[model samples]
Target: MNTITRLFDFPYHQLEKYNLSDSLVTKYGNDWIKTSTEEYLDKANAISRSLVRLGVNKDDKIALISSSNRTEWHICDIGILQTGAQNVPIYPTITSEDYEYILNHSESIYCFISDSEVFEKINAIRKNVPTLKEIYSFNEVEGCKNWKELLTLGEDKDNQNIVEERKNSIATTDLATIIYTSGTTGRPKGVMLTHQNIVSDVLMSAVRVPLRAGDTRALSFLPICHIFERMLIYLYQYYGISIYFAESIEKISDNLKEVHPHVMSVVPRLLEKVYDKIYAKGDALTGIKKKLFFWALALGMDYKPYGENGAWYEFKLKIARKLIFSKWQEGLGGELELLVCGSAALQTRLSKVFCAANIPVMEGYGLTETSPVISVNDMRNGGFRVGSVGKVIDGVKVKIAEDGEILCQGPNVMIGYYKDETQTNDVIKDGYFHTGDIGEIDQDGFLKITDRKKEMFKTSGGKYIAPQVLENTFKQSRFIDQIMVIGDGEKMPAAFIQPNFDFLKEWGSRKKIAIGSTNKEIVSNEKVISRIQEEVDASNANFGNWEKIKRFELTPDIWSIEAGHLTPTMKLKRKIIKEIYKDLYHKIYS
Candidate 1:
């Protein structure tokens, strides 16, 4: 068995061990295409040979931008790395201006895009990038160079030796890829990660995921440009789990049913949406069905693992699982044994309820610089904890700083920020990477993240409030879809919220209340405001008086990545959201 030290080595090792027939699957039109391990390696090698013919050199940077996850991206990732070149994966939803900044900063020489949507963004700024020699499209677009041309060029088999030679010369510690963090504010920084960084993280994170050898399936819809999903892609390959790319974000439910994946990775926001959608269905039920639904939901909310709530409660939960929670499992593909949430803090209620429903959600924590998994909730052993991010994985050491920041030291940490020593030094000190998140490890070794050190703000009274904690607490309201706490230098804390419009409309209809139809009209409804206030008042009991939201205003729009209210990873772009809703911010503060 070959020791897997590099990013490309994962699939090759899978071929030796599992020889999976469906190594990677992507939907084309209405058909799902499967690529075997042998085929995946062959195509990846072809990509390498093709790049060699195109004058690509070791350490040369190439940029890949995709509007959605696809099989080509993984092939290109391996193909690019095998040639000793690093690929830069950028967010497809970012502005052309951001596209120009990252391409220029990384000095990417060749660019590959998934479709015309991503192509248009890049092609608009293609002239501004002096180092970008040519553009290739994975999906054929009008008057664009296609990636197949490279494969065709390499088909002659003449430069195959050169590709192998390049592979042999590449060390395990060599640069693998440059990922531009879709930052909440400022220009994005290219986080340079070595082959070992991701490979080690994948190996360490694998022990946490319970799966059968090469027999299970994974549905990947989260942006592959993000390290969380990308690293999981490699991990899926390492586990011999067949990888299926959801057609689009809109089609995840349909794809989930079609593939019936055994495992999936989701962000906290998506899980919240799933829970909300499920709750809305239950809300529509009549009579005894409705009564039983709320009964199960109540029991789920108060759930604890390892029968900590005792035998009678556990027996009631088993009845709840059969009566109601089973449908929740069925909705997410009947065999969904696990879902790992990350990129933001998950509500403890969401984790507890979901786990109680028997669909285990292991909320993990890490950043792109750490090759992403610093610590994650595990299902094996007694590692299942409801509130924490679970125990730190083996080989990764986490210690809480005096300021309550999590500082990590491990092989998985990135080499540094690409070409920015000062920024790198700011985060990395004394051989430990400063995580920027305030967290504490429990006596039982589970790690719980409290809040972002930088995101915590102070009031005029000198009281500090952790907005994430407050937001997560309030989001348990089900009425609030999105909330941002704002009170810096103010007399008291307040918030700007995006109400769950779906629930609002249904609730309005159910009560025969005229809350109106449009987002603007609904938010302006006095009754709607009063209803949400009750929820806020209910949630405020969990917080200190200073930490509670004194007042809040509803936003007339949804907070989304495409709307500039959120980063691609679904974290709130607070500064951008503030600017977008300046009028709403003023209304709450005034």
Candidate 2:
């Protein structure tokens, strides 16, 4: 329990302290496959030995691309790190061009993949990536080598001493992983994080995560390529909590029923989807059932932390929990103790309602460069505050700049962006990492993010607008699914909305209104336009006249990652969105 310094030390710490029989679980077909801590270490060590045999050196880069998280990724992670190579976890959804760019940038010597799709992507770019020596797949692909072969090569124990030597030689400050930032603009930059950068983060952030330790189970579905989920993986291992990987995002509902996980990490986009599904279910009810559902929901929307609403509110909340919210708990597998929301700004409505439903949704804030945890809302004590990311975690210092950027200085800060001192220096100045996020620390020290500094824009009239804050608040409307506030060099601020089509269709049927099926049809429907206008007008009340959305257009398509309108993390690729919706943009400002 004591001497944990490096990333690999986490599993070893678990092996000694808990030695869990089900440290990592992944679903394959109908079976819930398990990899014990003993097996996890054994396979990792074997991969280490095999990599050594292949002449893999310290600081050598190895890239991993997985369609979804699996036990092999974790095993490969430990195995790769123990061999003193840096793991470059790449998003599976990105194009082959991105793969080639990151591989060449990191100078990755070996690449491990998940399936045939990923194998084909890498195979297509193999000629361009001359540094890549071999490709190994977790799932057997037709022409690709399987990872088991690498493990087979390391099955021999004689080279165990070499792995031990490599493990010992790896310092706490040594580079552990080279995470390529999902830059909305330009090529992705490699953010080089150290063992200390993450180890310190996991340890400090651990106090904020509520867990009973070894026995509790966690369901991990967030892209582990991102430090937010990757860091949580190490934290789960540190506490010996069993981690169950969902099959994929498409199958999360089924997996939730089977796993009944006590905890999971989520992004705001997922919460939006969950809320929509839950809202649709509620709307499907009839007569008094619908009335009761809405009454409970209305009570939920007025939620405040620590009983600030007094005894009467708590009594109604108790009834709401039994009559309404208990089903929300049951839908996500009757046993969700905590759902840590991160990666983007979560709508305050989502946080408030989820909390009122007896679902603890703690919002956290950080970046891949911070080794990812700067602050997180916790349920214990007075640690939580509504609409805030949460109190800053222990061992990290946060101070707002005069212009309102959240600057932080702490052990969790990254070593630097790999091979790019100029870009790194721009952000990390005077030992403080300028988060590029504008926020203010409240009197009680809860961090409330306003918007991304780079994203905030000044209109032609010199009126400044923070779109993300507006977007977050407006998304609280059940009708508006996604929105982008615009007016960068224009007369007034406006928006492009992607309405909650699911909710719209249900309401359409209920009201005997034909809102249509296709996105174009629904968006053009006069009734639908008027309804959305009402929601927009309502949300505009919270903003200044200059900042308020003056006129808005609805999109005929969802802004998504694959469509190139959104980044993988679900943040609006403002430039990309504008390019695609230029016609709509002109319609508003013309």
Candidate 3:
């Protein structure tokens, strides 16, 4: 059980012993900000000294509210850790009330905000949080202290010894971070994680998928507040890979081309969007090019990764690769070797299409409480099973409970939920953390998640339906952008559908159907409904009569994080969706 103390100590030692400097580059606007390893270490040490001068001590909690992924974010995080204080990350998208709750609960003394907007969020609730002493803004603010002031405060050379002593005094078991889960069910609970929990995951995951220094470049777009990306930042530094942060969510595609990164981690929603864009482009092609594009796509979707296809299928695949798939790779900046997808189950059809096009998508599964890397597909050895989240990482053990819930045991598991022993006990029992995800391990050691235990519901006929499974199946249709199956306490299943507007527009022109501009009119149109019914019927053909969706309601409104229908990671907030569409659900049942 090695700890992150050694991991944290490496940068300084690299500066002193190996003369390693200016290796990390972060993107700011159109310019790249390059910081030497030594420079970063010095700045972090200075910030640490400043915090001590501000009366911050070991075990104190410091909160950060930021949407940007500048080098300063990493420096502040390491600086807080160097002082043996815990870092509490707050999502910038969260409401002011959530900020108050987390800051008050953690008793954070100092808060760092990325911009004025974030500062305003904290400022609104600053009076409510009695423990908060100061708010530092990374960007210039009229009333708030800028983050650079800390460096000026720490200029005294005498504080160097104090910084070193504090770093050495911190133990691996000491709390390093307290990440609050973005609750779908209730109030957000802070999951306490030690250096041991996170470092073990980084080390084990590195062993599973070896990322080399000087060879791997990563473009980061996922929020640093997320454990998935936070852990990845450490892994990138450990492997000596240069990381380029995208300016914003909208700039990811442009950044990917400019960075030409070797590897990237993304949520499935982004991947889905990429596929949708590609499909839209394919649909826009004409004549021979259009026919060939679709033919290649069909062949790609039927591709078998393990070479299980017949000679005829293999022959067509080679032609598809040459004629169409190579363009897909080129479109993704021509250097992407591995695309790591998580945060939700990727549609298996989409997975096959990408892999078939030589763009390997490695889907993994984990939770924030596990320091996020539980299992990931092995890209090097071809250990990928299309629908399965690859083998559990080294040093982690997983088992299926009698009720089919996935239970995990590893050093990577969190210590407990902060100040909630009862809630912690409910999940962790006899050293195994109950994941609350229903899954089973195959003979090949791949784990396939069936559904969320809480999400699976039984109909009035006693037949259980996994909404995710049904939704995923329906989403394979080109016309469907999103689908949510509903059948709780009902005789059969129904769905709320969001049509793919691009596909529908093209379809409408081809069929001479007048699609209304408004969502209500579009959904109520007989022609649109009939087309959606066709797709639903095709999807239902694969399921039993009890499992099939008998009716559906279409919506024109897109689900988005800003709209409160989706989480930051783009996962549907099911309870919120159910509540918002209660009338629609009743209409389907009626």
Best by lDDT: 2
The lDDT ranking, best first, is 2, 1, 3
User: Over the stretch 358-456, how does candidate 3's per-residue lDDT look in tens digits?
Assistant: 888889999999998889997667678889999999899999999999999999999999999988999999999999899999988999999999889
| TM-score, one value per model | 0.98, 0.98, 0.95
lDDT of 1 by residue, 1-590 (tens): 66988888898889999998899999999899999999998988989998998899999999998988999999999999999999999888888999999999989999989988888888888899999988999998997899999888878888889988998898989999999884434878889999999999999998887867789999999999999999999998888999999988898999999999989999999998899889989987999999999999999999998889999999999999999999999899899988989999998889989999999898899999999999988777898788899899999999999999999999999999988888889999999999899999889999999999989989999998899988888888778899999999999999998999988887888799999979999999999999999999998988888888898989888888888998888898888888998897787777
Q: Candidate 1 lDDT (Cα, whole model)?
A: 0.91
Error of 1 at 15 (Å): 0.6
Could you tell me the TM-score of candidate 3? Answer: 0.95
**What is the RMSD, in Å, between candidate 3 and the native fold over all Cα?**
2.1
Of models 2 and 3, which has the larger lDDT?
Answer: 2
Which sections of candidate 1 miss by over 4 Å?
Answer: 182-185
Q: Is 2 or 3 the stronger prediction by TM-score? A: 2
Runs of candidate 3 exceeding 4 Å displacement: 1-7, 10-23, 310-316
Backbone clash numbers for all candidates listed:
0, 0, 1
